[model samples]
Target: MQVVLRKLGRGSRAVVGRLVRAPRKGSVIVIEFSDGMHEYVTTPVKRVLRLAGREVFYIETVNSRYRLEVRGREVALDGAVGG
Candidate 1:
């Protein structure tokens, strides 16, 4: 799924890419950039919060917080509705 990832802090910019790995507790989140390079959240994920009935997500990792918006298609991550 296509997604836009933004770190929640000052000076942060949105990073658009394809979702390679969905955020899960105890795992790293990964995104594949358009340039074919992959961006990985080196810190282990602490939690994943999804808005009810929406494709938006809030991910809290060891050292950073992120907002992820899934675009184009519905993604059913583990623990989400219909997953």
Candidate 2:
């Protein structure tokens, strides 16, 4: 699935890519960046929050927070876990 990942902090930029691994509790979230380099959020995921009736996701990790937006209609975020 195609996704845009942005770290929630000062001077953060969004990274567009394909989702190589889905987010699960205590697991790493992986994305194959548009530049062809794989980006990994190595900290075990703490939480995932989904906005009601939206495809956007907020993820909290051990050391940082992130905003992940699912792009395109070809993919459905059925595996996402939300709080």
lDDT of each: 0.78, 0.80
TM-score of each: 0.83, 0.82
Worst 10-residue lDDT window, candidate 1: 74-83
Residue pairs with backbone overlap in model 2: none
Q: Compute the lDDT for candidate 2.
A: 0.80
Native-vs-model 1 lDDT? Answer: 0.78
Q: Candidate 2 on 1-83: residue-level lDDT in tens?
A: 88898999899988888877777767888888777766755487889888789888899988889998989545566676855
- Please state the error at residue 54 of candidate 2 in Å: 0.5
Candidate number with greatest TM-score: 1
